[model samples]
Every structure is written in C-alpha cells, then in structure tokens.
Target: MTKRTNYSKEFKEYVTKLVVLDGRRIVDISEELDIPYDTLQKWVASYKTKQKEAEDNRQNALLSASEYKDLYEDERRRKLELEEEVAILKKAMHIFTLEKN
Candidate 1:
C-alpha cells in the first residue's frame, strides 16, 4: 500500500506561480519541480482563472465609481437649480408685501 503525499499551500502556490507568472514552460516546470505534467497544467489553469476574476473585479469597481461621480454631478446641478428658484420666490414675496403696504 502506497501512502498519499501531503502538499502544503505555499509549495503549491509557488509551483503554480513558477509556471504561470514566471513564464516557465510547463514541460520544464514539471521536470524541474518533479511534479506530474497534468497536475501542473491544472494549477496553471486555476491561476489564470483567478487572475481573470481579479481583473474583472477591478473593472467593475472602476465603472461603479465613474457612475457614482456622474450621479453626484447631476444631483449637485439639481440642487443649485432648486436654490435659485427658492431665491426668486422669496424676492417676489418681498416685493408683493411692500406693494400691498
């Protein structure tokens, strides 16, 4: 009976990074790391998936921030218009009162 090997997270992550980020070829990585080719390939694939997800999250955050800025500008303009209208109404009321007296 063969015992199963227990690998640590740091070791796996290091192996995956060597293959994916370091631009080392899979065949070379497998040979150098003494890991199976298919296993290394799977790790590289998962690493790519994680990188893509992170990029998508960053893009979404930038878009949301831009949208919030646009909405804030619109609200500011609306507030300024309302303030001007109120000032006009107050002036009209003052003039009306003086004319009546």
Candidate 2:
C-alpha cells in the first residue's frame, strides 16, 4: 500500500481557490502542485459548493434588508400623510371656533 500524505487545511484551501476561483484547470493545477488529479478535483468541487452556499446566503440577507427598508419607507410616508391631515383638521377646527365666538 502507498503511504498516505496528510495535507494541511490551509494548503487544501489555497489549492481549491486556485482551481475554482482562479479558473485554473484541474490537470494543470495538479501537475504544477504535484498533487493527484482526483484529489484536486474533489477540492475544486467542495470549494465551488461552499462558494455557492455563501452567495445564496448573502442574497437572502440582502433581500430581507430590502424588504425591511421598503416597510420602513411605507410607514414613514403614512406617518407624514397622517400628520398633514391632522394639521388640516386642526386649522379647520380653529376656523369654526373663531366663527362661533
């Protein structure tokens, strides 16, 4: 049986980034890094999956933030409208009371 070599997590992450993010070919990276082709392929796949998950989470958070902003803006507009209406009603009441005096 061949001796199993243990690679550090940092080394694995670097190799994965080279393959997935840098758009390097698996065979080329494997040969250049002196790593096995199958191992490099697996690392690339894992990195891509993690990257996709992170992007999805970021998009979801942005959507939730946008929704909250929309709700806040709507409430702000409604409050302003109500304040204007109350001002108008108060002016009308003053006019009626002045007329009654």
Candidate 3:
C-alpha cells in the first residue's frame, strides 16, 4: 500500500494560485511539484468554484448607488490611512534593519 501524503494549507493555496492565477497547465505543475495530477486538478477546480461563488454573492448583494458611493468613500479614506501607517512601519523597519558602522 502507498502512503497517503498531506499538504499544508499554504502549500495548497500556492498550488492553486499557480494554476488559477498563473494560467499554468495542471500537467506541468503536477510533474514539477511531484503531486498527483488528479489531486492538483481537483484543488484548482475547488479554488475556481470558490472564486465564482464569492463573485456571484458579491454581485447579488449590491447596495443602492448612493450607498455604494458612501461606502466607497469611507473605504477609500480608511485605505489611505492604512497606507500611511504601512509607510511609517516600513520606514521604521528600514531604520531598525540598518547596519551600524
């Protein structure tokens, strides 16, 4: 009997991304990753299905135009604030990582 192998969630996600986002052939990825062809195909299908379902739900749950505009404005403001915070953190990290002469 062959031993069953288990993959981590991050590995599975990376595999799915390679096939779904990178538009790579399942056969090629399967051979390169040393994973079973059918297993990789099923993982890609599941990822695509989830993406489609999320898109469908998002389209179905649309709000009024004005509501969307208001929500968009609020989200845009929050995004800008987060980006500023991230820039500050990156600068702080750069300072911390610098070598002292």
Cα lDDT tens digits for candidate 2, 39-62: 888888888898899999998777
lDDT of 1 by residue, 23-97 (tens): 889999889867878878888898889999999999877747779899999999999999999999999999888
Q: How accurate is candidate 2 locally (lDDT)?
A: 0.88
Error of 3 at 72 (Å): 15
Clashing pairs in model 3? none
Candidate 3 per-residue lDDT over residues 42-98, each given as its tens digit: 899899999999999999898989999999999999999999999999999999999
- The lDDT of each candidate is 0.86, 0.88, 0.94
TM-score of 2: 0.65
Report the backbone clash tally of model 3: 0
After superposing candidate 2, which stretches have Cα over 4 Å from the reference? 64-69, 74-101
**Best candidate according to lDDT:** 3
* Angstrom error at residue 28, model 3: 0.6
- Best of the candidates, TM-score: 2
Name the lDDT of candidate 3.
0.94
RMSD of each: 5.4, 5.5, 16.4
Backbone Cα, N, C clashes tallied per candidate: 0, 0, 0
